[model samples]
Target: MKKPEVTEQPGGDPPSRRGRPPEPIGEDVGVAHRTWLEPVRDRLVASGLTLDELVCRSGYSKTRLSELLRGKGYYPGWEITYSVVKALDLPPWPLRRLWTAAAREADKNQGWIENRIRAVQPLGPELPPVAHLGLTQIMRGPYTAYARAFLQSENRAQRAVGETFDILWLTWDEAVAVPDTPRHAWQLLRARVMSRAAQQDGHPDLRQAAFATVAQAGIADLAERKTRIDTMADFFDAIARLPQDQMDVIVLRHLCGVRAEAVPGIVGLTPAMTHTLDHHARGALTGLYLRTGTTVTIDTLE
Candidate 1:
């Protein structure tokens, strides 16, 4: 394909810049797309390379490169994507994982995905040893439980945790540089979970989970079962109203069954702070139960 002709300025700079500054990636874009697209855009901007230059290096036409960069039209295959990734000097494996996910989200078939990926040569380097170890630790930790409490699906919670680790791996350097690495990592995990969490009055809606509690009660009568469900829903709503730290404490300690000792590490709080938050959250829930005259026995809160 003939590349778009670039007119040279006095200093031999290409006149055509990265076409129209790439359309602003809005919330309408899927998370998978945003995950990879944002980094690619950042790398392009940081590299200070023009669209004409990218076309020359990627060996693709400017129009195709422009559309791919803007995330317009259909999803581009891995061949073109890897070409651009190489041209920008960005890490390949993470982008490959992210791109494959976005492609799947776009409804591309497995056969097509395999074919497209096979067209590109695989890169040699892998996630650093320390980052891999950190990923393993967080995976085995209470993150999935915390995620499951909000997401409510084993598959979704697992995906959220996996994606969080991928993001952490990508930003491992900056994460380690922070004063509190666990806290930084927790924030990333929280963002990923909350983005997909069901919302009620701007908080994560946990009412749906109340059914499980009601089910465990084994109340057969329809009227009693409904009352139990409603009461549990109210309790969950109250839990949702707690301050962020307290709410996290309640969810991790009570809903997720994470042990008191482990709560501090998972939520990135000191032992004292975790205990205080748990205490305050229980007190607040107890007060709500008392005021409403709900006769629910919460063993965990006790």
Candidate 2:
């Protein structure tokens, strides 16, 4: 199929003028997340800094930035997005204009991402250690990488199960199952200390219960046996909205059954502070669900 051509205007026609629709501005860019690059490239070109000069301020390698601008290779992250925009020192409106252009270009080429993914032939499932992947791993970025691989291997229903359980449960189980460095020991010790503190605090039980709620929620979220149509989307959407730090609060306290007092030691917060954060998060979610009135049909965990 012939690619659609877009007309490029220095601020005039778009770059291509094929069957594709004109890309939307920044706010309208869909959730694919790397839409910032198109704008980043435009800013670098407009600033007259030359690639070398832009790299000096942005700290990105001039070569890599150039490759991205020329569409030689794709990037998995948008460090460049914020960097180029920041380096330009452009007025906010100017930066916004560039951002809009980039988003349009990115949306136009979105399929290239899928083609790249399908071409990967990594030795089967050499799934990385969860620690290396980090918090956002489950929701976006690397986590999205995991989900794509997972979907390729299994049906949506099974992938959903793995998303809830294998993706998370297995990681935690595996982490605790084997031994690792002093750092890992320290993390475990921290959790124990916090758990003890929660016991000392009268709210220990509440902390434990709150933790359970989050774990169950995550599990339900992952396995997604939810029979209701679109419940999976809502479940995943809700999880996506949760920050890693807050998700940690859920996993540490609920799934692990650690009391509130013990949470701070493992997670770097005070007992009072942890409690506040947890309550606020739950309250916010409840409000979100109520406002959206998104009902999830749940399947009981086996």
Candidate 3:
């Protein structure tokens, strides 16, 4: 099927967007890629194009595109970015000179670019650029994907803004995995099974390496206070895998620390059922603690 051509009405977006337009924001070409090109990439994302469609027209494979989004491979000559941006039916002339100069400067110091990416990633998960990617799979995602600018490293400042958003969400994912929740039962079922994600060996955060080692040892953390945190994480690996009903109860009881009286509003479980559920969860956690030797800060709970 052929795609129809759509035309832009007048001088672009009518009323000027308040604050500053994202162009000419920086002087040095290298810095401009991070500062200046941001708005350009953002303009593309605001447009409506699917990831797959964007890649096809842009000529860069999905994998390469992903790296660029992560701020890893933004060094390719202007032609590549040009092809991708132009396919959206927008002009790329003036922007070309800016980014072109940025690319040449980028070539001189590739290592510094990746280090900047590392600086913005949060403490826990760091999804690196995919390795061992084939050409076919690489071309599947959008290059100038107007949508991915949401996920892309558009620029350092923009990425810093995004990392903040992830921090809040991660806090919640952590809160929900507590074992006193009916969700804990689901976790006990898989304690030893899910402890194999050792990819954090190269992780920049010490906690990551520490946790990965804990999981591999079937022990979560050795430090007493940190012990509860890690054990909670271990239990969550399994709880997170449970059915929705059970996970909901887990969150109600443990994460939010809601009492049995409030369980009905959240999970629709009767008061009697919630009480029984909490009792069994307590017993399960106590028994697991004794058996697994997962330690917590001494005298803190005493």
Better of 1 and 2 by TM-score: 1
Clashing pairs for predicted structure model 1, backbone only: none
**Model 3 misplaced stretches (Cα beyond 4 Å):** 1-30, 107-302
Candidate 2, lDDT over the whole model: 0.42
Candidates by lDDT, descending order? 1, 2, 3
Worst 10 residues of 1 by lDDT: 1-10
lDDT of 3 by residue, 1-302 (tens): 12332445566854432222222322443553653355444544545455556688888886765555435533644455566556654334334434444554567455543443344323233332132123113311221121122122245323333222222122222324453322232232122112222222331111232343344455434675366456555654433333434544554455434555656533435677766665655555556556877653211121
Highest lDDT, which number?
Answer: 1
Q: Over the stretch 180-256, how does candidate 2's per-residue lDDT look in tens digits?
A: 42224334333322322223223222222223234545545533433332444444345335554564565455434
**lDDT by candidate, in order shown:** 0.79, 0.42, 0.41
For candidate 3, which ten residues in a row score worst on lDDT? Answer: 142-151
**Which TM-score value belongs to model 3?**
0.26
